[model samples]
Target: MSYRELIFTVPAEIAEPLGDALLELGALSVTVEDAAAGGYDENPLYGEPGLSPEVQAWDRSAVTALFNPEIDHSGEANFIPELLASLKESDFHLAQPSEKIVEEQDWVRLTQSQFAPIQIGKRIWVVPSWHEKPTDPNAICLAVDPGLAFGTGSHPTTHLCLLWLEQNGDLENKSLLDYGCGSGILAIAAAKLGCNPVVGTDIDPQAMVAARSNAEINHTLIQFILPNEDAPELAADTKYDIVMANILANPLQVLAPALVNKMRVGGRIVLSGVLARQADEVIATYSQWLKLSVWQESEGWVCLHGELLSAISNEQSNPSHIESIATPQKKRLKLVLLSLFFLVLLVFAEHLSRNSLLPTLATRIDGTSSPIAVSAFSLLQKTDEILCRSLRCINRSVSDFTAWKINSASLAQESSGEPLKIPANQSKLQVEIQNRLAIPVLFPYLELTLTDAEESEIKTIQFSPQEWLPISWQDSHPLFLLRGAPSGESIHSELAFVMPQNTAGYRVRIFYSH
Candidate 1:
């Protein structure tokens, strides 16, 4: 869980290059924020937002990259000194180990300790902080506490999907597949909505543990599996009526073809986790196989729902279908040779007619438009051989034969809509959470609590098919000590100890690391 954060200031011209070099050096994640901006002529760290109090007019861009020790250390540190030495008046300092860690306890204390009940699909309650009874008029509730899983429902993307399902009405008896099931919230929701044979798959095993626990809590049946398992065969055998993949754009695009195969001919596929800007490319990837339709848009994100088009079959007639099996076509060399000879003659004649015989206006204009001119031509030139060698890291697989070609012409027009503006930081922080244990973690790992805030209470709440945990954080930590309630509630909300705020210097503990 301990990560080294490389924080430095660099000239704008070299910012991008240095960032890329660092990533190639072994950074796990790189983030660029518009810190204090000032003039480059002011100070060495010009363009950097804040000054060090000692110097007032420092203006430089601060670029920070976080690298995981699990990845590579020697590689990252190898050329650092050389790279920094090249810059004129370059100033760099490494932060102490304690300064880099964002104390989890401090975060826990800042968040107000409370859990609120969230209702999903008429019968599931994603209760986190405390256990509560489900009293909704027409819904069954299952309670669950999902920690570090993706399906918290607070994210606009997840909420949009749940809203879509809710409005779609009962999914009774419809087979469902939750692709990239993070915390297995969608699959569980499908089951609670009356869907049968609910199945979930993820690239992470932690998600499976959470999903299985969630299923048991819900008192419903759901099959969870890893992506590269016998599950594909099972899925093909029992085609699902609904297939939902809420993963990000790149992976979604790569998995589009395989995901399409999991659905019945006319089954519905719901794709979320796509930013508005990236929506078009994602849609185009699967447009040929399915009649992709815009189903819902919320919070600068979109959920595309597509119906499998019957026209897309294993036939050659479909214009969009590209067969993996190659078929060779023989060409008549004699005809090609004859065409090339004639083409050269026409080009030469056209050039002479335009340049030499163009004295008369009428004759020149008429001759300029050649009827037999070749539309396009290219020189078939050869290049010298270059020595090449390949090395494989991590997966150690040989060079893949698969070829990828980008078809720009077919790409949907990029949206010119304005970027959604997120609310500015507020003095008072409020976090509402709903969790189901059965899913994997994605980006934006929960920063559980903030420094100097009262710990959020964990309580059992009612949900469709079962009850789970809901965590809510509010208020400051120094005031209230938190611990599991002695009430022996089905689930304990709030911790039993209070952490003293580290005001002198920052200290962070990896309370939980996946």
Candidate 2:
């Protein structure tokens, strides 16, 4: 259930305090604009119906603030009741205005437990968390969960193409792409089918994260990119051997030109996400851009496959094709060498003139240069190997260290049907903090707990923090060593054993930094 705005015409003096109290009560965001000062746009995209049949001067003077108490249709009727009580307690006098702004209750559930995995083809499965992984060896596995936006791979359009891929031409050595990739399933499937350098693009960052995580889980080397519809840089100007899009009809129309441009001259394209009724419209949109070939239709979904046709005129008299002539000019090799020598001499003379004959005195910064130089010189090709091994270790340590006070960590564990708990007030300061242990950990089986000085349990530990780091433990357990630079973009974690809670302050762990 979303929130509603409570429009009250109160005196200007009490508006600020009233808004604050309402916020404290549970409003998500509040805005107080001068209604009396007219000419301001009220929601540029959507225009709300007027509050009353006839506008009152009070409605213009009073601040209309929106509150999201997380109420539903059944709960909205109680708003005036609570407002009346709050008014009486605040000792404010008010009257009902001429108009009422009533919004239909729309129940949106952010919790995604009801969504299940989707079966694309006979052997391809897109298993979201709500369903179990398919046991069939032939099933191509895809682990993901959709939030807010679309793409679970169960849609008719996605299934239609998956079926086609399962029955179609060889995917080996083919460069593939998933344009408007919602969850990157198609792109991942291509990589799993032996396509090299599979690429996926979406408009959402959250979707990109989900896609990357899914790719990692599936062990597919697909690169997912979040590209703006208007920007070309985000969608690197490169061609692919095979491209597929499961996006809708309208965007598909606009995407045809861009997508066709991305395909190699004779490369294939698979376009889904169109209704059966809209298939002809989609076909017509792409026909002008590419030479439309065979199409596959299943369960009212259409997947168009085609080779790109040259837009250039195919008629004769255009010289059929243009050719390049590389004619070398005759020259004296000795004369060219002499010219190069003179140029080098001129450059060296200029360099000598730019620098002083004597060495200038300089201040030397400590430590920064060597470490920075070493890190910069390290081969980037091995960064992933380092990250995966180190992150796995950090995750293990965090799991072995503590479990309480961490609410909603990104490290997803298998459903044990038991809530993770940590002892509270345990003198164990470091290991007792739960949230501190969560962001650094990334495995599914590890657990953390808190114990006392005498190894007794106390209150359940609770913890929360905006950021954390995973510091890699060296070969030994007691000593910890840092591998990479302290990165704000990536999280780092460390482990600690704690005593059962007693509200004891925490001491920092000392570690060597590279």
Candidate 3:
């Protein structure tokens, strides 16, 4: 028998979900790896250390999934196409993935061969259950399975943390807390090294389970709990002699106050999973309660060590500063308001994308955008008959709506009717606008949005046909002036306007005004 493997390469944001989607579609197994692994761009993901993941850090990720041909399904020959169709229904737009056939083999043994006894620092060694412990009696083997959680003493981030623990020699009776204790590797090693009352905490429940199991295999008495646990020893009032955290930079800064609060005065703190360049910022973030310095550097990653010599102000350590789902009334109110603001923007974006509305270009502008605003406000106050005569009217039915829509539009520097001057910052907007309906309709308004290099809105302006249409063209087509562009007729016109300062991009949309 043989297994079918399908592989896909996609952006980092889509990798994890794609893997899970494959699993839900009956894949036997799925694996995700950096698409650029071993290259200069490998795993170039970085975020300020914090609780949430920074998926934007990496450019691309590779995902591979295996399927058993014998599993009940449609035709085996058409299995891949059918699976892809199911994936599309689940909102994953993907191309045909690369495929391969794997003959049956001892997968478990093959996987076990990849993980061997890895000795870290002087006294600690990470040994998979399938491998024997090191011969050295001093070697403290942590029975952690590779990939069971996140850490297994192989990655540089994990290795650096282990080495730091080893150098701390004689931790007997000293309390240590392993923040984000994946697989409980650090907590178990600290326990064996004589640390009393070792504790580990992670947000992921699965990590908590894997960590507890690993601690038991190592025969270490480590208290493993989730961040939300009510364990008395990990209450708000509880503090540790030493605090260690190995997470990305973004989360580190975000959790600075909480992590620092976990340490007793004068207690040491160790932070790993930080890039070399982000050291200063991380140090600055924790400077309020402690002084952190680079303890060691390996493979562009650094382990930070610090001593908390002073107490943080009550305001700095307030519950608001810490991450929690239980937010204060005021904060929740602010969150609701923020959500509403974004919702309004989304509704407008759709309307703006499909159609546009504007009053008119100001008759005069001597280096000022005030006239555009003035004209717009004036149009709003105008009588209904006047407004309809100046701009297009909305409120068309379904079939009529589709028939009358903005076609294509473009914005560029003015190139005709004599050279344009730079002092005015002028540009020409060309739109192929028309109404396909059998009856004539009012000319639509043109709304232009100017944005900066970062795509942030700088200014917005709307124009009526009389304000933007060329005087020469209006004279050439007498009927268009009286009856709006006329039915089945296309009006390809250039609208010129003064660009706002720092304008780097823009959007042009034409739509009937309600």
Candidate 4:
């Protein structure tokens, strides 16, 4: 069977009334859209959370009404004339409607065909229920269909967040909280990827309904609740290994403390739905509790990632511990200043001696050097020498052995120091690794593999950060190496070790500890 689609160009005041009139005049359905759509002055309505536009219809509206021509009540050969007469009788002075014959088809198949399987990251494949089979059967298929709620895995913000979750392969049995979870897609994905005891919370009660339904359809054990619900997992004391909030920048900044409180110490946080321009402000807002950096950006949107290295709270947040460390740092500063003062005084004292005589000589009679005068002169010279020696020693001892900053003359030397002097039993290996990722991570282990001419591994040695990093650096900035390398930066290390015989080739590799 075929149906007739009538399109009428009507003004804002008449659009809604015309649609209602058409429905009463044997029209099967009616949908109104903007007449100037796809043109220069095209207008679109956007209703953000808790807000909506004043009028639902556009200034110039295109009202489309579907009618079954065969079931016309007037028994006329043509239904257009009869429908127009009825609308005119009802005081809807609409223009002559344009007509189109639409052939009936299986709408379910047609609608489902438009949404193919989307592969996200490595392990996730968002498959609709009607898809029947996925392109990659081994992929962790998410049985999600387009719904009224957000997060269908098609938008860039949702895609980037899903990509992060999919690529993270170490989520086994980790607790997760999907804050501001819409449709519970993230919570469901995390649960499928081995995140146990997952909880999803949103302020909207309808979101909880959609989240629960989606979780049930995916066969994942998840707890979906409103933010104020009496759930143990969402209590004030509860903390999660991973806290994901794919919310906007403004809300994220406002809820920074609340979200940080949800994370356990050393736990990771994933954020999304932030514009590229707004990324910096959001990062700075969260930096107080933890360091947040842009993990990835897509279509002018960015996903931020960070780890909560320390516990953060509103009341205390360990201020006493911070002051304790600050006290020692202040003492060190005072010691440095005192050392500089002593060095300056030593220089002044040496100037007074003038390389010939001390103040004691000026007090001597007949310009002759006495025993007491000589003793005082020697004591002043000795004190100056001691201060010079002690300060220089301190400076040299505290200097960076491998600071790797500033261009160096030694950097010109190749890895193999002088090909002629390449040691047979012992060799020096230099390794430099650059972090290509956007976010910083903990320092990785450097692995050196020794191979013979046949490419078989003759021997290998794994160097932990402690082995390759300078001892002074590790002692001074212990948390830096523990946190990770700076984003898109390089680290250099040189090692001298005993080499096994028949070592003709070598390979260098770097990776995080675990």
Best by TM-score: 4
In the range 137-175, model 2's lDDT, one tens digit per residue, is 888877766654456666777777777777665888888
Per-residue accuracy of model 1 over 25-61 as CA lDDT, tens digit each:
5666666443333421122322212312332222234
Candidate 3's C-alpha lDDT? Answer: 0.71
Model 3 Cα lDDT, one tens digit per residue, 46-97: 3343433445323446688988878845227787668777887888766445
Candidate 4 residue-wise lDDT at 97: 56
Candidate 1: give its CA RMSD in angstroms: 25.9
lDDT of every model, 2 decimals:
0.51, 0.52, 0.71, 0.72
After superposition, the stretches of candidate 4 with alpha carbons farther than 4 Å from their true spots are 10-18, 36-41, 58-60, 72-93, 132-138, 203-210, 213-217, 247-257, 275-291, 314-514
- By summed lDDT, which 10 consecutive residues of candidate 2 come out lowest? 357-366
Candidate 4 per-residue lDDT, tens place, 285-325, comes to: 98878899999999999999999987664444666678867
Is candidate 2 or 4 superior in lDDT?
4
lDDT, candidate 3, residue 125? 81
* Model 1 ranges off by over 4 Å: 1-115, 119-125, 129-131, 140-142, 232-235, 317-514
Clashes of 3: 13
Model 4 steric clash pairs: 441-484, 442-484
Evaluated at residue 186, the lDDT of candidate 4 is 93
